[model samples]
Target chain A: MKAYLKKYGIRLLIVVFLVVGILAVGRSVRDGGAGLLSNVSGAIRTPFQKVATAVVSRMEELYGYVYKYDNLVQENERLRAQLADLENQIRANDQAMEENARLRELLNLQQKHTDYTFESAKVVSWNASNWDSSFTISKGSDSGLEKGDSVVTEYGVLVGTITEVGTSWSTVETVVDLDTNIGVLVGNEQVSGILEGDYTLMRSQYMKLSFVAETGQIITGDIVITSGAGGAYPQGLILGTVSSVHTEAAGQVEYAVVEPFTKLDELTQIFVIKDYQVVE
Target chain B: MFADVIDFKKLRLALVYILCLAVMMFFQDTVFARLGLFGVKMLFIPAACVAVSLFEGGFRGGLFGLLAGLLCDLSFPESTFLFTLLFPAIGFISGLAAEFWISHSFTAYMATAGFALLVTALCQMVRVIIVEPGSALTCLLTALVQTLWSLPMAAVSYTVIKRISRWGNKR
Candidate 1:
């Protein structure tokens, strides 16, 4: 036993040290491990992983089906009622046509004012962790969306920005994210301030509007728009409405809370703003 | 008949290992997930480490560790491959440590568990150094939480491994 222990002891130590050293070196490199090792590991693991993933996915699908059955029934009933209402509205078609024309004109006006080009993308997946407010969009390099591109909804409300862009998928760090900041202008007043996320709440609760002079003409209910200050976002896009204002004792500088217009949690579709001319 | 017995043994062991791995992964996905207070995830690594230490030895243990780490890495989509390498290294080192520094005593098992916890803590530190050097304090706090949580998991894994090894030897 002693001889066996003595023989293998140093060998085991060497192996441990070698692995630790390799890992440390691997950490420095962008790729964790070399090609063959990673590829082999990936290949060997993929099938088993896939099986496990499939099992979990199927279980989740079943759970979702069962859980949403009641909601589905409710939604179906609601939709049927709405469908009947729409049918009745179609019978009295003149008013419906007028309303559609009015909506088309408003949409056209919105399009004319906002020269920003949009690429529509679907939200494919969301991070399971509620604390990390990020989601993956289907659009990527192939769709002409790149990192640092601003994302918004059809109503032109700020959604988030593309932080990491892969070939087929990209991650959007929403306005709710603690690290996010947007340069915004308040309504027709043109009162500019920086909008930032609050980490503590874990929601898009309030934005910290900073660097506005205390003497600057600022008031509650001012509509905040993208100033195109930082070149990350385009000019004249609606961000939110100012909810509250904060004043320092010195009265030289002030801040305001801007409630974002986008209902971030319920977002299913978003437009990646593709072509914003940088001011700088 | 002899070859059949050998095949049966190998198949049984493989199945047992897979089942253990599945259980570990489920706990990691659910329980450690909830424990992510202030970026600190509870230590699931030690469970894999302890299991590897007791049931598997040498290259096999290392491989199992690598496998466990890879599975854990899939949960974090952002940092794609970094965790894959770091965690396997922890497992391999912990298993190696168990093989070398300690004898097969209750104390040794406890010591192995402690070593696994230390390894997990060190791995978190290494991650902090590589990924987010600025967030060392946060990582350190998280490491401490992970280490604390790993003790009981390691003990349980030790028991499971012991039982599995006994069952393996019987056939």
Candidate 2:
């Protein structure tokens, strides 16, 4: 028995591993849920990821400053001149009109949604896979986050939805992830449609708004926002502007490409909406 | 004398390899994740696996492949079965091929590494292809670009592992 074990042990182990791999693949495809291995590894790696992200971010900032020093000097001089001109224009337009309007808008939004609960999280690491657009955040269920919670920018632009949460870290599937689907209203007509990530569009950091009626009047540069129909996402969260409109080959279907307001690549901090009253 | 009997050189080599793998994982997860060309990210782990396997032989290669595969799966947002299954197979086959037919040369390593990379790229897109048939062409193009972009990682792996292997030989 000992001799037999020595002879075929490698083969037996290979079989076992293949079985495990197959099962894992099946589970991943079936539900897209994290397994025990994922949870344990995530718990172990979260701290390291946080440190690495911080170090890399600092290094990038330093590198940018060093590399762009000369360019920045020249640009700074140009910008100073431009700033003086803009300041003159601003004084001429006077009443502090732009600042007043911005403050009023902020006040209106604050007064309108008095029930929003915000929890801030820093992005620790991006998903290493080329196939998906998601990132891990430093906050998780420990911070009162849950799967399906909406994430947004500080200015109330929709970023994504939390899909997987570990004890201390959560994965945010961004607005451009292939699996993300959100109901959106477009243009002044408020034409309703389902906005989803498309494989081709995602590479360009864009999403597709489909199911619009053939008669729907969504043109280029139209504002798109969350419809808040099903209470899944908050109403009036800025999605993006329409980049271009497209029609199906048969002309029976229409879709518009939306360039999201919050650039996914530039995000460092995000706010998760822990709870919100359904605004309809 | 005790160290020689226990082959301390091998032990030291293993430790160094582990350290190297960890550093590579760190860079792959953080630095490489942010830097991409034409929307294709570099895959360092697989290239490192192939490099180590070619020098270390089948048994060790397979083991390292398994560890690297697990890390790759864990690190990605959408975990796939492809890396866990394919990586070890690539390691084992590359090891055997190196032992029997191929020389430990840059050209040979690149050829084998390219094959491993192409397989990974194709396998990654199989689900996307099945679910979104219309996007098949775009996925294929992306996969090709990823494979091309990842070749420099293979070159780096070769240089690093070659130096390590030479040190082991000298000792």
Candidate 3:
């Protein structure tokens, strides 16, 4: 045994060093820098990470070009069909202009919780791991992006939450991760439930809205929004639209399938809601 | 003169291996990060290691694999040193296969790449099974996509490494 150890001691040492490196990183993520090794590693890899993200951004631009062209082609076909409805619809809408304005006045947001200050970030890379839905954003602790800060779209739709932070980079775990569970409110009924990401539903780009009372009747296409009950997220941020609802065989518990408002896959740039007032 | 020749050869090998690892990491992290073609993230570095192992030796490939693993662990918090162990083993196996059966031909590239990609897909499958068993079906599809995407990259790596080796031999 001693002879074998002596022969392969260096190799064993390297392996130990590597395992130690990962543990340190896992520990340091909550606090920012892992130790000497993780810090050094993150620093050395920073430039490469930046370049990797930049390449993706450029590719997204190219993809957007192709996507837009495809959309144009599809739009042309749809327009050919919809041309008959367009003039009639426009005339109908023009007549309802006063009613539309009245509805807008009623639905106009007053920003009851206006304490939100945001930091814009460019998605630098995605989690290559198949097990989770996450990505790295360019801004980090330097931008006041703390772990648990909310991430969102330009339209203030909830995307994910920051889970890990470094000096210049932070990882955002999307709402579709099985580990994510947030208190949510649904529809005009004010139905309350725990919105959670499930491993199975993730493939379909959906999440589970569970833990509702049997008294609450949820219909298809009902909008889900953050309830702000746990103070983890601000209230009224759009989560998703109800796709399906399910009831247990015992009928004691119920859950609704939610499809996110934003296409998580197509998001290249997002905003970090660094600070927000917790509404009770 | 003999000692100098050996030293130069070792230096060349190290340089080539390091360069391949760096470039592969760059492409995988930056380019492949966002371009999820067909729901699979392209793993281009493994192909580089397989190419070098075929063109040079197993030890060089294993070393490159080690760095590649380290790069993954350091960059992505979710990835652990299990990657470090896996990549080296893959490198060793690819190198061994290259030493025994491969030549500087398209067939060799295909064989090496197919084997390497198979191993990578296996790891991903295991990841889905062990870590997130619920995602197995979707992960399988992703693994297939990743393997297909990596095939062409492996061919490119084989061609590039072959040229690099030719230069090293002349020098």
Candidate 4:
């Protein structure tokens, strides 16, 4: 028995370890909490990720400068030509006025939600999984950022929510992630539905507003906002605009595709709403 | 006393390999994470594990795989142990294959890496399929695309690990 055990002990141990790992992972998933190992791993990787993010940003800037020099020159010449035209001044002034108004609207985001407390964080690194849409941010529990904090743009566009938190880092699961589901009201009629991240729509950076009643009036370009039905999310957070509506093959149910106002790929900084008055 | 118990040569090789692993992970999380191809991102760590396992034998390879998988799980959002369990097994099997059946060649490495990637993709798909049953076809397609895209990592990992292994073998 000892001889046989010696020969196959490593393999037996591997099997036992795998079984234990499976059970532990299942429990962790059920509890929705990461264990100590994950936290330690996050701690170890955060500094490296920060450094890498800084280096990548610098490299991108350098690459942009080197590659876009000719485009910049062409743009400069066109701008100079436009400076000589009378129509250009009026168009430029109009654009400037629109931009000023937009800036004011963005600034009002803070005033608009006086009950909400905000903490800003920079993206350190994105998740490497092709199946997930999440990124690690610079602040975590150390900054009083909790697991369910809603992340948003300065213009009050819903980005996502914090899914996991470490001491100094947290993972923000973007709205396009397959696991995201937020209660949303669609259109000016405010047809209530669940904004769910669909696997097919996620590829195109869109989500599905499912569970809509067939009689609901939802048209293309209709704005969608948080319904705040269960008080999990804050009310009136602008999620996106309805891009399209569809019906099930059974023709009994309807859904809509929403394109988010926030350009997720362009986000470098975002704000976390740690505490918000959830008005239903 | 510690030197008597541990081979300094192997320790040097292990440290260098860890450094290489860190660099690969850095690039995987930072650069490859953003470079989407047909809606799926590239994953290189599984292939890297295969390459290291092929050269390093079972014990070291399995240890490296465990480390790599832990890091991968850390980088994945809300993922606890998917890679942590899969990668060590991949490393052990690949190492055993290398010791008994396969040659330490690029073709052999690619074959093992391809199998490892397919297994990894399938495991990832299982969760999606369970949660979003309506998107089974989408998940399958994504799994295939992810596997195809990550195949190139085999060549990269093989070239890098082979050179490092050769360097470590020198007296």
For TM-score, the strongest prediction is 4
lDDT of 2 by residue, B94-121 (tens): 8999999999889999998988888888
Residue A71 lDDT (model 4): 99
Model 2: what is its DockQ? 0.48
User: What is residue A242's positional error in candidate 4, in angstroms?
Assistant: 0.9
Model 4 lDDT per residue over B1-171, tens place: 897999999899999999999999988888888887796987878888888888888777888899999998888865689999999999999999999999988898998899899899989888877888998888888888888888876689889998898899884
How close is chain B to the truth by TM-score, in each candidate? Answer: 0.77, 0.92, 0.86, 0.95
For model 2, state the Cα shift of residue B83 in Å: 1.5
Q: Which pairs of residues collide in model 4?
A: none
> For residues A202-230, what per-residue lDDT tens digits would candidate 2 score against the true structure?
88899999898666777899999999989
Chain B of candidate 2 versus the native chain B: what TM-score? 0.92
Better of 1 and 2 by DockQ: 2
What are the per-model C-alpha RMSD values against the true structure?
A: 34.3, 35.3, 35.6, 35.7
User: Cα deviation in Å at residue B48, candidate 2?
Assistant: 1.2
Candidate 3 lDDT (Cα, 0 to 1): 0.79
Tens digit of per-residue lDDT, candidate 3, span A45-138 = 9999999999999999989988899898999989987996898898878857844553343234224346777777888777775556888999
Give the per-residue Cα lDDT of candidate 4 at A101: 64
The 10-residue segment of model 4 chain B with minimum total lDDT is B71-80
Q: List the residue pairs that clash in candidate 2.
A: none
- Docking class for candidate 3: incorrect
Error of 4 at A105 (Å): 4.9
Q: If both were scored by lDDT, which would come out higher, candidate 2 or candidate 3?
A: 2
* Residue B64 local lDDT, model 2: 81
Indicate the residue-level lDDT of A210 in model 4: 89
